[model samples]
Target: MSISPSLDTDDLDAREVTDGRYTRVQIGAERAVKVRAAYTTRFVATEFTKRPEDFHMLAGSEVHPEAGDVVIARVTELGKHTRLESPTSRRQLLFVGQEIMVAYGNRYAPDQFLAHVPDSLEPCHLVAGGGLAGYVIETHASIGAATAIEPIGLLATREGVVNLRDFSPLQVGSPSLAAVAALGSRRPPVIAVLGTSMNSGKSTTLACLVNGLSNAGLTVAAGKATGTGAGNDPNLFIDAGAFPVCDFTDFGYPTTFKLAYEEVRNLLAAMIDEQAAFGADVVVIEIADGLYQGETSRLLRDPLFATYVDTVVFAAQDALGARAGLDLLHDAAVPVAAVSGLLTASPLAAAEASAWIDVPVIVTYDLCRPEVAAALIPVRAALL
Candidate 1:
């Protein structure tokens, strides 16, 4: 394995090795530990670790590892020396000779690895660009084999072993009751973006909405309430003119998969409250995966979620998906304000969907218009 010439090999002392004499050093804040970026949203300081046994390889990678969850891994082989997409979306190279810190997480995307938590503390694959160290139970045939990594041990300190959950700002069954009440009391008009499936133009729709709303001079805040740890979606929201954009990772969750209903509810409440506190005229939240996906479906059914969100913008891949998605939302009593997504890319498909659904059918181009956004804002009387 080759080391990057820019990095000083000597900086990593002999004691830092797996032999474990314990070297205390700070993990830099400038470069996010990709898998753990979400944790950094709340805790943005350097953390100290000393021992490998302090870390544990969690089973069942249903949820991607949250930012700040520490893992010990060894480089088993070298790849093409590509730069890793950090939690902050910055790119940096990983050297084969280096012992590194990573987080266990799962990702659900059609274009990427469909990974899971390894059942054992053994060699696994780097299944995600965000350094999701896991076992590649499945893969999109378009992409080749996953990057292999060996689990050395758990990250630890003199105090004890460190897990991302330990540093979470929110706790299970112990959400801030005041914040939840406040969220319901002073909630801003929320436009939630849901899709037929991943890559169904959810992020694109979000960006268009943010951009259009910003262009209309409305103060907007955007958030991705779920999905794996990655900088791309959040970055898009930021670039699209949203201030203080965030995602599930910001709440110290690597991914929202399989999380309890109350916990997920609290996180959403917290996120909405934080953005609403920013005094934005509107808050645009994107729910990951399709409407039928586990977390998304659960949230759609949660009464708390319905109270928080005023309107829904369903995105679909085609006319059929739009019809099905609209039907599902209708059955759940989730109001659909508009229909948009990849289907809008084709006028024929959009027209086909428009024939079936009563709401406005918006294309990517139309979604970028301020008038389209202005039309979707819920009437003040309706909130009452």
Candidate 2:
């Protein structure tokens, strides 16, 4: 894939990511991290819908990484959709202003690579830098109305980037399923979280649960599944009294687009294994995006979520979405513990949603209302 001019690949620098503890290298922070792993693939900038110029600059250049930049990845996998794959070559190097040496051992052409991307599939690229690394996939719209990721301005523009410091896939269980599967073969029960939408009260709700569960003397370990990697959801969970919390960044995937369906499942299973291995009494998880919102959502319906998550919570914005979410669960046969969302924050809204979904509706603010999260704890445990 071609690098974007807006990326300023012209000025690649090897620097520390704010905290000078570890040297930043490649498309990730530090040398590497055994943390929650997140995945995303970078696409051509000219093709970008929002910041179009990111790809326009590197129209024909092949990635010849130098200094800090390491692998110049070419899509090795072709699919019905535009799925970018990571090339397996350790020799790939990240250098300063290194116009990828095209003839070295005959690297594949970017145009040739794009040729295989099906017309129906959305396109993206993999980006790397000291400050911000990993794949930044192109999206038509920003995630949700109540976006979980709020960019904190005034960030140091080291090597010109701003990766999500808050909830990354960098700190999770393991990198692959093979290991996770092996781990799970010898582990115990694990606690997990699931959801229906973006602002569906997953993270905040997870924090509240952790606080309560911890108070009840459970050794709680928490983890965040997905979100815009720009905020500190895991930190919030940690502060909420979780002894340990992790996100995708710890796993090494910078964006979700970089992960395949089976890969995500395997890694999640691995995370469950790790959490169980950690020996936390109850594991709390925050799911990314939402269930029933995409083709993947259908996957959630097809017994996949039941297989993975211990308890499922549907977060909705309004009564209509809440009802729709509940109906989707019924259709998919997903046994959910309870429903919660912005509506619960307001009394009138909660009452409205309660009318739509018979399941107990929780508004985290009024935790004293015993029915809010009280009823769902057992349901969640049943899944575990």
Candidate 3:
């Protein structure tokens, strides 16, 4: 990729941009370094991986930014869009789990899947038109009123269905996603928690991070974009003194399994917005599923998540997984703050985790220690 000549860095204040975060600045002479963007919004530098976890977000505004170019973005909190249609019928789209289907007269019929709607969504919602298998959607796009779509094909929705097959809506002018589809000119550092499989302590680590940060005299806002809503991570964040704590429970998905990509990104954006609104100093988001799982693997290496993450903490089960996670984060340029896990009796487990991941590893036997949360702050801060 050709490097553009840098313009005046002084004039390129991060506070100026309203929507997008500056990925690479064209300043006078100096080349870009591993420095913060003018805005804190996240962008990916690259996507394809020759190494472990070398994931990136989609290509950005840069011209000819190579296929593997890393994309870094400033992640905003999750944004929520709820709609009540004119006929006293209410259509709500949570950031996750719910799909936004755009009905095309032929294949995109919203009523097509009336029988196949998930058992979880049983009793099928009584949509305005008597809940057509395909439902009408309303979008801020210049298009007219109803875009019929099968509920299952939906990636996201507010009052209208958004098809994941063509999800440009979250890109720019996505009235429901970002303020104006522009990156937040000014963004903030992000904190993320990832794990090595289901039940690997991801949410628990996130709670600890929120509590740890809050106890350290910093404002904290917590978000749970995915998960089955088994534990009360949101409640834990609130109880730990965070100003505002939230989870997909609020959006109604309460889990990440059925969510599509468009739905996930919008949910993430909405959560960021929510956190920012709370004015918290740190925003923590937890990613469910293993970092290397086939289902969520794409998101694990996702540039969106990477760009938004200031620090990434991984929960592991053993030294091997710890090593794999550490290597992945190192390749992606996401800082690994610490490793958390539960193990049987192994004296060398902590040492093994620390040596491999190159960060402090905390093994909790009590599963009820208040001090466990505090232990993470100093270790995490040191990475910065």
Candidate 4:
């Protein structure tokens, strides 16, 4: 790391080309930060809103990384993830020596990798395609090593290190989740989509429901209550006719794996409120991973889960998973409205699941029907 000659800080408006690379701006006479081929990703899109001149300084020394703390890093090695997901959902390719901007966050994916934020700005892995930088603690055997990146420094301003939460619209002066849920004296029904495990088809089921509800002449809003930060699910919901779709990331969370139960509830509540405020007739939320996962298990057992969610659509990968999943939800006192997932793709498996549990087993096409979709929502009048 080379420290160029300190430039005048008094001329805040003055722009100078430094090192023929990124513009080097002087926060003060002591600190000199340079911005080079930095590619900002989707993780920091909410708070990385500063213009080129808006005090985009970098602090290299005494770097302490925390979840949602935006940092610049140089791509050192390309492995499993060769491209990053941009704020606009574009996949930007990575190359050695190229700089990129991402956030520090923990990840929990049984089918992929489990990673945590590193204590120092040392070499770390690109644990997620959403631009999450962390050191992977564990990974599935099927996947290769994570992409590697060397930390350049933390993104900073005059106040301090720039955190995603600092500029989050949902967290800054926002009402409490309870208060938000109580507005208008009438809360819309929330259909929570849960699954047996990762890649169990939870996202597809949610999207199908969104499409079905829209065809039934009801305004639907969708949200992802927990998961590693990414744009794929939200984009799918939008294509399915959901309006004002939200996820934990919107609340400045890169991932909700280790979040407290209250935090997860608030994430769900805030998203539901945002959709309702936008005049949605109903709201649907998806809980990442399976019933046994940490956050998901705790949330289901807690009473708060029932307050905001009216029904649960259990998604399973097999007939046994569907049966076992329904049993788990039942044991947790959760109401199961329907069962759908990979098992539904097989008529034999679907029939087996239906025979095993009294709940109706449905496929994607079933959810697409206007009448079937409209019926999934428990009579709203009964709740009020």
Candidate 5:
């Protein structure tokens, strides 16, 4: 797909333009692009092939772009903020009339916008803060509109397109499943934080739990096993005192949407094993989106995933969601450790959720309490 570069002559910045194979521009605050930790890595010195198809397109493609997949994009439009949020959660500004290299992928958030591969590379919108450029198919009214961007092309080398997947530190075979299983008693207990939907307070709750466990003097390794790429949640876990934090991006997936069940399971297992290898006493993991989301539902149903989870903490927006989510978990035969989420904000809502579900209703604030978090740990004997 080709799009005419949108230039506002009056809005031009006084920066010198360099002529080269790849023009250097500031990376956007996009999670998918964060795989390489671009805020720091910025750009890798690599060669590119001019063939567009050889490079991946952000929208309307079956190819699942990895977080660090480098693509050259033109700054078609500037937004109110010139800065981009880095994988480490740092924001940096961008100057118009610059050619920036970024990752290509889609983002699906019920509270934000739903974007996918654009029908063509013709200019699309930056649908996410984490530099996810795609065709915005739908958006929540609250977010208004997406940031506009024009695709220049994917970064390629003489060998082929330099996909972030090729550079991923987390490989499928590196953390062998058999090796993890060999740990046996050394594996830490895993507490999975799942939600009814995005913005349901899963990350907040996970951070609280991480904080509580850390305060209890337990070494905690935290990770987001699934979700669209972003640094926010994993960073929160780190700020909350998780010794080491990771997410699906580490495994080279830009977004977890539409991934096969086995692939999702393997990614979660690999991450869990890595945390366990870190000698953490406990691992706090958050699955992105809701239990009903495509990948999430499949993962929840997979017995392999259940093997690693010691307890399940369900987060929801309201009593209705809590009830429905609880029912789904029960039907799947997955253990339900507690009910929490946005509903915790209101005592009435929390109480209402408690009435509908038999599990304890722990608000985010209380979850930070050491004793409260300790009490939520499922019996080790039961897990056995």
Candidate 6:
């Protein structure tokens, strides 16, 4: 087998090719080891559409692993996450000794665990249901400890450690600020959904708006700009009639937490370009977490972000959060067309928010309506 260019060839002499399906590599000159995994591996969400046959070897020599490196691990204990989300979106129950394939990534969900890739392959936590493996530093008091797992080794092929980046279906070569700026009226109007925090109904708002736009005879493309990797939101967008749906994960990132600002900006640009290539009339993107979150705040404040977003739909759980969130957006000069989310579920709370903010407060039902959804589009894009 030809060695992949991306593979680390430093230890080239240590590994020798065999005629069988598995290759034999000498860990040291004195010892020749044929490492074989006897366990049936259950793949996770981040390994989307990959099969066991895709990888031929496992290497545990590396102590420090980077985010997006695929690893094979055995469940040591089941805690908050008793089940893992499969690549097919099925919730597979977890067992104490089950071996699973997952990707390493940092998690920044305040409602859950804040985790980072471990320096060593020591026991770590499954931080997100999306198959992120990291060492938990902090977790919400309301939730139980994260699920524990022991790393067997990183999944590898002739190319070396299999990274999701190597398998991305997207052809988004490079981010071009000039290209995005030049689109002007030719590109579709983009609406961004931002929330007070995780689970503040941002996904629902985006999905509903997409549904309304699709119902209004417009092709809608949707994506989540930043967040931990997960299928729930993307699936929701698909069910709501969004074609060419995307998220940070689709670009090979298991999560957007801790990523550089330029990387995140380029990711947003790529997502829009991917959807626009499909001839979408409007694009909707969701930014994970509240305005105060580091990555979210940076994206909101960046001038490049303004070039991609036409307006924003703010999601909040209460009147005070709605008011505060709107104020923050206003301060950042982000154009917010409406207020919706958990706050809109209750008439009293929505009324209170409406009284405090000048923007219209809308509910899911209203957002699904063609006329109401069309109104949310900025006049420039709408006219186009």
Q: Which ten contiguous residues of candidate 4 have the minimum total lDDT? A: 30-39
Candidate 3 lDDT, tens digit per residue, 244-279?
A: 665653443323444567676667766666565545
Global lDDT of model 5: 0.68
Per TM-score, the best of the predicted structures is 4
**TM-score per candidate:** 0.79, 0.55, 0.49, 0.87, 0.80, 0.85
Query: Which regions of candidate 1 are displaced past 4 Å?
Result: 1-45, 48-68, 77-82, 165-185, 381-384
Superior by TM-score: candidate 3 or candidate 5: 5
Give me the displacement of residue 101 in model 3, in angstroms.
24
Ranking by TM-score: 4, 6, 5, 1, 2, 3
**TM-score, prediction 4:** 0.87
Candidate 4 deviant stretches above 4 angstroms: 1-50, 57-61, 176-184, 380-384
Count of clashing residue pairs in every prediction: 11, 59, 65, 1, 14, 0
Q: How do the residues 1-384 of candidate 2 rate in per-residue lDDT, one tens digit apiece?
A: 122223323333433222222222233332222111112212111112233122111112222222112122233222221312212112233322222211001111111111111111122232221112222223224321110111111111222222232223333333434334455353333444545555667677777767766666567777765433323566678788876666554554433432456656655655665565566766666666665434346456546556766556667777887888778777777666767766677788888888877787877644323344444565435322
Model 5 misplaced regions, further than 4 Å? 1-68, 78-83, 176-185, 381-384
Q: What is the clash count of model 4?
A: 1
Which is better, 1 or 6, measured by lDDT?
Answer: 6
| Candidate 5: tens digits of C-alpha lDDT, residues 1-384 | 122122232212212222332222222324223222232122232212222222232222222334345555666677522555664567756656555555666667888777776544467765555555667788777656666677655544334445556655566557745446557656778999999998899999999998988877788899998876667777789999997787877777667765666777888888888877777888889998998788888888888877889889888999999999999999988998898889999999999888888999999878888888877777872222
- Global lDDT of each candidate: 0.68, 0.43, 0.44, 0.77, 0.68, 0.77
Candidate 4, residues 1-384: lDDT per residue as tens digits? Answer: 112234335455444324333343333222322322222234344334444344444444345677877777889999998988877877878888877778788899888899999888889999988878899999999999999999876666556566767655566238646446668767788899999999989999999999999998888889898888888999999999999887777777778877666777777767777766666788999999999998899889887788878999999999999999999999999998999988898999998898999788999668988787887897753221
